[model samples]
Target: MVHEPRSQTGLSRNSDTEEIVALAELDPESWSAILAPRLAYFAAVARAEHVTRAAHQLQAPQSTVSRALVRLERDLGVDLFARHGRTVSLTAAGRTFLATVERALGEVERAAESVRADADPESGKVAFGFLHTMGSETVPSLIREFRADHPRVRFTLVQNYGEWMLEHLRSGELDLCLTSPVPDAPDLVARRLDEQRLRLVVPEDHRLATRKRIRLAEAADETFIMLEPGYGLRRITDDLCAEAGFRPRIAFEGEEAETLRGLVAVGLGVALLPPPAVPRKGVVELTVTGQRAVREIGVAWLKDHPDTPPVAAFKRFLLTRKGRLLSFSPAGV
Candidate 1:
C-alpha cells in the first residue's frame, strides 16, 4: 500500500493526510539532540513567528536561533518552518512538532519538581527499623504524629531485634533504628530514649501474681518462657538471671511477645518482659529487683549518616516527640 506524509499546514491538506509516516518514529539519542535542546526556543519561535523576536526572548543571536532550527530540521530530515521574506513561518510539520514539544517539556518539568521535593527534608521516604516493644507503644504514635505534620514524607517500619538491627543500620540497609542499647560500636551513634524495667509476666491468677515487686532471686528457681536467643529482651532476661546467680529454666522459647505472654497466661511459665503496655487481657506484671534490670530504648543510626538532611529531619522529629512522651536522649549541640 502506498502512503504519503500528512501536512500540518491547511494549504497542504490532501486525500493522503492520514497515511502512516516514518517521521513519527524517533530513536532516543536522536530525540535527545533534536527535541531536547532549544525545545523552549522552538516553542518561542513557533509562537512569535519572528527570528529577531524569538532570539531576543532566548537571549541568543538571530543566527544562533536559525542554526538551531537548521539542526532540528536536519535531525528530523524535514523542513519545519518556511522562510517568508525576512521572517519564518511554521510549515505543516512545525505545527505538529510544537504540540509534542510543549507536552514533553511540561512532563520534564513535573519530573524535576518531584525529585526536588523528595530530596528535601520535608518530603521523602524514611526507611527505619525498631524493636517490638517500642513498636507496640511508642513507634506507632510517633509515626502517626509525624505523618500528620508532614504528609509528603513516608515512613517504612522494619521490626528487628538485637545486634542484627545494629548491623543493618551501619550497613546502610536501614535508615534509622529503635532498639535497646547494645554495646557501643565505633561509628554507631545512639540517642537513649527511655529506660524500661524488665518484669516477670504471669497469669493474673498465679500465686506470685499478687506481688507488686519481687527480687530477681525469688524467681531464680522458676521455669521461664522466653523469646528465642538473640532478641534484646531475651538477652536482658538471661543476663538478669545470671546476675541473680542461676540460669532461668527454659520451658519454651518463641518470638512474638503475644505468644510468650500467652504461654505465661496458661500457667505454662513466667517470662521476663519489657514493662507491660496492653495489659495482655489476663496477664500480670511483677517488677523484679536486685538485678535492677532495665534496658535503654534508643534511636540508633550510623553517626555519619545521621546528620543527612532526611535522616536528620526524622531524628529531630523523633527526638522532639519523644521528649514530650518520655524523655529519651541527652540533647547536645
Candidate 2:
C-alpha cells in the first residue's frame, strides 16, 4: 500500500488535502459554479445542527438533504460536520465557511430587492433627459403635472443639448429625451410634440430692437452670438441663416441660451434663440418673419428599447401632450 505524506498535526496529506488546495485556487466563476448551489444547504444544516430539522426548515425531504450534504462534503473534500446521534456540530472549516456564505447570501438578497424596487409599477424610476432650456420651466411643469397623479414615480433627470441626449438614448443611458429638429434616424423613434418659434434677440438700444417683426436678411450684416456647433439650436440657427441668404458672422460661441441672451443684452451681438423662460431686462426679442423661423421640438427614444413601467407611463403622458407641449407664450408673442 502507498502511504501519503502527513502534516505536523498528524493529518495525512491525502486526496482531500489536494482537493481543498485545488478549490482554494479556483477563480471566482469556477468557485461559484461548484459551490453556489450547495451553500444554502450547508448553511441550513450548520445552523440547525440536525439534518432532519434543517430539511424541515428548507421544506425538503430529509433523504434529499442528507444526500446533498454528503455530496457537498465530497465536492469540498472536507468533513464540515461532526456527526452524532441525529445531530451534528460544525468542524473548524464549516465555521470559517459559514461567515462568508452568510454575507454572500445577504448581498444577493439586497441586490434582488433593489431591482424589485426599481421595477415596481407605482414607484419605479425613469431615466429622463431634456434640453438645458427646458430645465427652468417646461420640464418642471411637466413633472409637477405628472406627479399630481403618479405621486410615487421617481425620475433621474439629465439636461444637455439634443445630439448628446440622443447618443445617451442610443447607448441605453437614457429612457427618453426631448430634442429639437426632431431627429430622423433608423434606430430612433421620434415625434414632433410642438413647435417653438425662434426669435431674433437684440440689445434694447440696437437698430432692430423696436421692430416687432423683421426679415432675417436684415440681420445679415450684424455680428451674431451663437450656440456652439453640435448643439441642436446651433444647427437650426445655421439652417435658418442659410435660407435667409447669408452665413452669420459669429462673434462668440456659447453653450447656454441664457448666456447668449446676456451677451446680446450687453450689445456683444444678436442671436436667433428660443423664448426665454423669463424675459430679460436689456434684450428685445423680435419675431422672425418671412421664413419658417421655428424649431420643432420632439420626444425621442430607442426604437427597440423596452421601457420599465414608470418610463412607459411617462412616455404615454408625453405623447398625449402633442401640439400643447410648449403651451407657455414667449415674451412679445
Candidate 3:
C-alpha cells in the first residue's frame, strides 16, 4: 500500500521537504569534487601558458611542473594537455575548462578585493594600466599629478597593448586603464578623456604627402608600415583599407606608433596613425579624403569603484582638460 506525499505548498509539511533541504545543503559531493580540483589545475595551466614567459616562471623545476600537472590530470580523471617536443598545448577539454576557471577565479578575487577595499579605502596600493601609445602622452601627466596629490598612495603603472590590457582589467589586476574605446564590457564604466582623428604619416617626398585630400585607394599600392596584428590601429587601418576596396601592402611591422612614424620618415613605408602630440621631425601629416578616422580615449574602471578617490580625481582632471585636449586633435578634427 502506497500514499501520495503532500507538496510543500500544501497544508502539511512532508518528510521529503526536510530531505530535499538536506540534499541542497550537503549531497552534491560529486559536483564539488569535480569543480574544485579542475579549477585549481586550470589556474596552474593558465599561469603556465598565459602569464609566464619561460616554461617555468616561478623558479620551480621543470620536473616539478610536469609532476604537478600529472597529479592534476590524475585528480581530474582526464588528460588536459598534449605535448609535442618541448611544447605543451591544451586539449579541447582543457580550453573549455580553462575559460570557466578563469572566470570563477576572477569573481573570487574581485569579491575578496572588494572587502579589503571597503576596509581600507586610502592606504592600499593601486595599479594603473595604460595602452602603449596613450601612455606616451597622457600617462606621464596623470602620474605626476596623482603622485603629488596622494603622497601616501603606492602606485604601479604598466604599459601594454589594448586587448591584453582589457583582459588584465577584467581580471582585477588593474585598478584602472587608459585606452581607446572598445566595445563596452558590462562590468566596465568609461569616462571620456579625449578624442582624436587619424592622420596619414608619410615620408616627406612621397606623392600623397603633399596632398590635403587624398583618397584611400590612391595610397593602396604604397607600402604600408603597420603595427602587428592585435593592435587597435592595425585593426582600424585594415578595416579602412578594406572599405576602400583594396588592401595595404605591409612592408614593416612595429609595435610603437612613434617607431612606425619614424619608419615612415625614413622611407620604410607610410603609416596611418592617430594624431599623437609627439612630433616626428621629417614626417608629413596628410588629410585623407572623406575620412576623418576618430577614436575616443578614456579612463575605464570597474563600475563599483566610482568613489575611489584617485579614480575620481583622475576623472575630474581629464574632464576639466578635455576641452584643451580637443585642440590637439588632428587638423581636420
TM-scores, all models, native as reference? 0.62, 0.80, 0.58
Give the C-alpha miss distance for residue 79 in model 2, angstroms.
Answer: 6.0
- Tens digits of lDDT, candidate 2, 1-333: 968654232323344666667877888578677778878888998999888888899999876677667657767778887877678888999899899989998898899998788777899888899998889888998999899988999889999999999999989999999998799999999999998889999999998888999999999999999999999999999999999999999999999999999999999999999999898999999999899899888999999888888889999999999988878544422
Q: Tell me the whole-model lDDT of each prediction, alpha carbons only.
A: 0.74, 0.87, 0.67
List candidate 3 stretches off by more than 4 Å. 1-124, 146-148, 303-308, 315-333
Q: Candidate 1 residues 1-333, lDDT tens each? A: 965333332122232222214335645555685457868778888888877798899898877776666556655678888877557788889989989998998998999887575557777767789877666657777777777877777766889785888888778778888887644777887777667767787788988888998888788778889989888888888788888889889999998777898888888998888765556677888878766788777787787663446666788887765435443212110
Candidate rank order under lDDT: 2, 1, 3
Best by lDDT: 2
Clashing residue pairs found in predicted model 3: none
Question: Residue 295 CA error for candidate 3 (Å)?
Answer: 2.1
Candidate 1: residue pairs that collide = 9-92, 192-328, 193-328
TM-score of model number 2: 0.80
Query: What is candidate 3's lDDT per residue for 1-333, written digit by digit as tens?
Result: 765543221212233556445445654565555356446544665556521233245555544444446545544557676654445567887787778878888888899997576335455456778777766556676656656766665567898877777788778888777776553778887777676677778898887766776777788889999989987778888988898889899999998888898889899889888876566688888777766566667777776754466555555655666535445333324
Candidate 2 global Cα RMSD:
5.5
Where is model 1 poorest over a 10-residue stretch in terms of lDDT?
9-18
